[model samples]
Target chain A: METLFYIAAAVTLLATLRVITHVHAVHALLYLVVALIALSLIFYLLGAEFAAALEIIIYGGAIMVLFIFVVMLLGPLAVEQERTWLTPGAWVGPSILALVLLGEVGYLIVAGDLPAISIQEPRQKAVSIALFGPYIIGVELASMLLLPGLIGAYHLGRRLSSEAR
Target chain B: MSLQDLIVLTPILNLGIFCLVTMLAIAFRRNHARIAAFAFVACLLTLATLPWVASATPRAVTALLIVDRYALLYMGIVLCTTMMVIGLSYHYLHIQFRERDGIEEYYLLLLLATFGGLVLTVSVHFVSFFLGLELLGLSLCSLIGYVRTRRHPMEAAVKYLLLSISASAILLFGMALLYFESGSMTFRGVGMVVKQVQAVPGLWLGGVVLVFIGIALKLGLAPFHMWIPDVYQGAPAPITAYIATVSKGALVALLLRFVTDIGALELPSLVHLFSLLAVVSMVVGNVLALFQQNVKRLLAYSSIAHLGYLLVALLAGGPTAAEAVTFYVIVYCAMTLGSFGVVTAYSREAGDAEQFEDYRGLFWTRPWLAAMLALSLLSLAGIPVTAGFIGKFYAIAAGVDAGLWWLVLALIGNSVVSLYYYLRLVVTLFGDKPASATTPQGLAIESPQTSGWMAICSLGLVASIILIIGIYPEPLMELIRTSVSNLLMVAQQKP
Candidate 1:
């Protein structure tokens, strides 16, 4: 199980790197969907089955499709457009920094001083009770957060469509 | 959940419902004036409910929110400032937008932003804080770019959105780290860990510093202040006022709560870090302000310095810290809104009258607006006879009491350095009009429109408040003392 978790984590990291480095938006979206799926696999390995399912369903499936649609709507990019900005200088520094971070994290895990994850699969009933009980205000506040977000999106989108006309 | 909880939550509840109702009213019929009037009245009603909410006295409505005098005081300030913004936005939008354009949604976004600020003041849990911050941020993105046809506002909106998203990500990561260390999300839970522990972990300190960096970026402190000038310059005038005041003020309140809860001042490392941020922010903010040609950008830099001064009070953490911070925030909001309100009043159909050239001889042309702007600039400079002076005095006093000599000196020096540009603008207001200068398009000199009058009256109200507080600070100080006591009591009770 631990080996599988590592495998999933490696796949997720590779997919994320591809998503960041890919020149084309469509390819990036595909890689991002792959990363999300691998992330859900890691979640499942951690015993958060509900979160894993939700992650795949909401992020990997629904959001990926939306992203693809938006990219399609934006049309094809000029071939060298992003390449001009994505020179080696841009990625080299960040990649080296990321490598250092990865090494540090790997060292910490191998040191075996950190506590192991307690794998408790949260029941759907328990999740609902927690969400509706003490966290109910947060739920309500989240709704408020989405309300303006939707309005603002629709507002900006309407203006864009009108401008296109 | 319970009757008392609902009652304690009335101020937020009332505003939240009004936001929805206002949205519906716009959908039912998009009458700009009617909707603006409805939002203004809704905010007024929310302000009215605060006293009742206060009567419920220090109730934890949920694990997420704690309604106390500290939250209520900031809420009152937020609501009042929003009302002023709504009033100022009315004519500005009316003249800016065509009749076919939907201006009513601006009010909806404005009210939602206010609701977000209100939620932030009372948030005790990370969930509520993140939600509130996002709500405010998302709404602000649209509001900043409401003039979508213009390129600058759009660019400004995108800049603010990208930077703000990164900052929020850092904040979330910090919260996750802190939760990992303490196994808790509530402020009180973290406070308990801090209280019980003998030696603090490095992970916890890392989380705290990351969180402060995120918030300092939001507050536009020195090193993290790249976005302020562009965002401030590009946003519409009234919305600029909103960003400068309510958005940042709520964060200050939250920072105070978190710092006090953890007894962060007791740690020398944190004290040194804060003092460093304070001094750098003051010097950087003031120094940058010295060269700004645009009024909005100038105020933007001045605001950075002002926040740095506020950090001195925050660093001075003791019985007087919260009071000093609160008083300074109120004074900051009043002066900021007053100056931005003047900008809104004089803003033309083309764009905001942000250039120093636009204000040249403004006193000769428009005395009332000029006087208000002059007074606000004086306050921003911490000149005598304005609330900014008294606010600075309190901050200095708190710093002295805490023995933060260098931070206090930096603050005083920055205030002196800040006066050059502020007075430069004041001189521009009274300076000679150029012979070649054409009447800048739509200079608000045609006639006294009703909406314009309403905007001017609000500016007058802000100016009067500044003077009243400056001249008679005792009553305001008394109020702030009580509120700070309530805050300290709550912080103590948590552990």
Candidate 2:
């Protein structure tokens, strides 16, 4: 189990590194999908089936599709034309970030609660109850946090979209 | 939810429902004054009903929020400060910006931000804490950039947003680490677990420090203070005051609760770390302010020093320190709000009267406004009779009681140094009417509607409170003492 965990962790890191190394946004998005899938596998191995499936559906599938749309809408030529993006100057920063990420993962593997998986699995029902029970206030507050972002986004684009502008 | 839980949550819930209602009202008929009045009345009604909230003391609404006197007192401060900011903005937002179509949304955003402060005060758990902090940060991001056409405000908002978002991410990482180390999410649970472990792990200490860094970023302590002045200068005057008082005050209250909950004082080294932050923030904030010509930026830098003074009381760590922190929050809120209140009133026309020269000869033309600004500045300088003086003295007393001489001496030295800038501003206000009478722009000159009178009247109210608190602080002092004692009795007993 420990070996499998380490392999998944390494795979996730490698995929994310590949994502950054790519010049094309499309290629980066693909690498990101691989990284996220690896993460879901880790979650599944940890006995959080609900979380693993949610990760795949929301992040691996839905969010990736959205990113692809944005990249397409923005024109693939825009990124493809920037062939100079692979310069050594850019790699210096990303390499540093990659090193920091590696350190964090290594530390978590040693000290974090990444132990062997137990047999008993908590189902989605329990997750719903927990969300709706003592933690219900968090759900309500989270919506409030997003409200301003929603209102502010609409207001921001209004001036540009109007005929007056 | 139970009846008790619902009632205890009213302060937060009221603002949230009204935010929605105001949105609907705006959609149906976008009337600025009506929407503003609706939002204002909602805030006032929330304040009115706070007495009822006091009846259900120390009730934990589920596991996330605990409605107690300490939280209630801070909530009252946030709500009152928000009310004053709203009153000021009502006038400023209408006249200054010609494109007033969606400016009404600013009030909706204001109520939401206050709701954020309210959530923070009552939060006992990390989830609520982070959510509240984000709500406050996100709303301010929009509010700071409300006047979109202005290049400076846009720049300030983006800077504030990027830094704040990164800070929040770092804070979440710390929470994750702490959860891993202690195997619990609640503060009391973390304290119990950490205490039970005989030799505390290095990981635990790392988590604690990481958490502190994230908070210091929010507090705009020395290391993370680069954004303060620009954000202050760029934001509209009323929102700048909001950032100084309600926003900072909520975080301070949360930090106090977290410190006491986790029994960080038992670990003397952590106490020393806070003392170190106190000294650095005091010296750095004051020194930085000495060079600033813009009054808003000056106030921004000065607020950093003020927070450092409050930290002196916090480092003292007892009921006395808590009372000092509480009283000074009130004094700080009144003065910052009043000083910025003067700025907001004079900010009706072309540009805000921010630069020191802009305020030159202000006394000659607008004596009443000048006097209020002077009084607020004096209070900020810790001059003998104002609220700032008493707040500073009490904090020093708290440090003395704790025998923290080094920090005490630093506070004293910084206080003396800070007087130069505060007096400089006051002297500028009273300086020989600037050569050739460079006419100060805005409010008094324009025959603005009742909104002008409303904003000025609110400033007058804050000035009176400052005088009352300064001359006879007994009433406020007694209330703070009771609140601190009530909260600390639980705080010390838990660990």
Candidate 3:
């Protein structure tokens, strides 16, 4: 189980890196799906079965499909723009920064006195109760937050008619 | 929530319901002036509920929000600032959009953003914090880019959206780590764990540092301030004022609550980190402002410096610090709004009158606006006879009381350094019109009848408040002291 966990984590990290470096939006999104799936596997290994399932279903499956649909809708123009933006020179700076972050994370994991937080397989019923009871305000506020996000997306995406100008 | 909880939350609920109502109103009919007035009245109604809310002082409505005088005070500031922003937006959108353009959504987004700010002031849990922050952030992204016809606002919006999301992610990660360390998500619960701990654990310290860094980025502190000038320059002037005042003020209020609740300032490392950020922001913000040709960008840098001065009060960590910070935020909002109000009044269909050259010889033409702009600049410079001087004096006094001598000196020196650019702009406002200087028709004076007088009245009110606070700060100080004491009582009782 430990070895499998390490493999999944490594795969997630590699796929995430590919997602970042990929020039094509579709290709990057495919890599992102792979990363999400591997992340779900890690969650399963950690005994968070509900989280694993939700990660796979929501993040890996649904979000990826939506992203791919949008990429296709945007067509190949975004790919050309990405090519212009993701020049080899751009990679060097970000790669260096990522390396620095990697080193810092590695050091913290090795040296820091992190809390030994034991993971429990959270029951689905318990999660639901918490969501509806103690966290109902959060759930409501999250929905409220989505309203402006939807409005913003629609407002920005709408084409202005000549008369409007 | 119970009936009492619901009643205590009246102010936030009023704004929330009004946000939805504004949305419905826009769907029904799209009169720009009517909708602006609606938003204004909605904010006024919310402000009116504060006295009723005061009757239910220091009540924790669930684990998520606290209804106290502190929250109420900041809520009042946020609502008033939102109203002023709405007033300025009325005239701004009036000029920026024609009859056929759908500009009503700007008011919807503004109200929603203000709703988010109000939520932020009362939040005690990470869940509420993240929700409120994102709501404010996402709404602001749209508000910044509301004019899609322009390239800069869109670019600015995209920049802000990406950076803001990144910051939010960092903040979430920090919260998760802290939750891991302490097994708590509520500020009071975390405060209890911190109080009981002997030596600060590394993970907890890292989490606290990351959270502060995330907030500093949002606040446009020194190292994370790269985005401010561009966003300020690209956004509509009124929205820029909103971002500067309401958005930043909400975050400051939240940060103070979080720090006070957790007793985070007692950690030596955190104090050192804050001091470093304060000095750097002061030096970098003022020094950069000295070279700005654009008035908007100059104000952007000045805001950075002003927030740096604000951090000193935060670090002082007492009832006095709380009072000082509250007073400083109010004064800052008033002056910033007044300054941006002048810009919005002068802005035309082409773009905002952001260039320093635009205000040149303004005293010769449109003396009223020139005077308002000059007074705002003088106030921003912390000159005597302006509210800003008193704000700065309070900040320095707080810092000195806390034995933050170096920070106080840095703040005082930066105030002197800041004077040059502010005075430079003031000079430009009063300078002779060059023989070759052609007054663009956009810069030409508009009749008060066509241009909304609501904006002018709001500006006049703001300027007078600044002067009033400068001359007689006793009443405001008394109010701030009471509110701070109320907030401190809650913090003390929690542990």
Which candidate number maximizes TM-score?
3
Task: Sort the candidates on DockQ, descending order.
Answer: 3, 2, 1
Q: How much is the lDDT of residue B403 in candidate 3? A: 91
Strongest candidate by DockQ? 3
Superposition TM-score, candidate 3 onto the true structure: 0.92
How many residue pairs in model 3 have overlapping backbones?
Answer: 0
- Pick out the ten consecutive residues of candidate 3 chain B with the lowest summed lDDT: B442-451
lDDT of 1 by residue, B1-495 (tens): 889999998999999999999988998998988999999999999999998778887988778999999999999999999999998999899888764477889999999999999999999888998899898999999999888877889899999999889999999888988998988998778767767889988898888888888888888888899999999999999999999999999989999998888778888999989888888889988898899999999999999899999999989887798999999999999999999999888887777889898888888778888999999999988888889999999999999998989888888888889989999999999998655435655453542333376797799899999999989999988888888799999888833
Shares of reference contacts reproduced by the candidates, in order, are: 0.72, 0.65, 0.65
> What is the TM-score of model 2 when looking only at chain B?
0.96
**Ranking by TM-score, best first?**
3, 1, 2
| Candidate 3 off by > 4 Å | A71-118, A163-165, B436-450
Model 3's CAPRI class is: medium
Clashing residue pairs in candidate 3, if any?
A: none
Candidate 2 lDDT, tens digit per residue, B92-210?
88776665668788888888888999998988888999999999999999888887766777888898899888889888998998898887778777777667877777777777888
Superposed Cα deviation of residue B303, candidate 3 (Å): 0.3
TM-score of 1: 0.91
Stretches > 4 Å off in candidate 2? A1-4, A18-28, A71-116, A119-121, A160-163, B435-451, B492-495
Question: Per-residue CA lDDT of candidate 3, range B1-495, in tens?
Answer: 899989999998898999899999999998887888999999999999998889788899778999899999999999999988888888778777764577988988998999999999999999999899999999999999998777899999988998898899899989988998999999888777778879888998888888888899899999999999999999999999999999999999999999999899888998999999999999999999999999999999999999999999888988889989999999999999989889888787778889887888888877889899999999999998999999998998999998998999999999999999999999999898755425656444432323478888888889899999999999999988988899899999943
Show where candidate 1 strays beyond 4 Å. A71-118, A160-165, B436-451
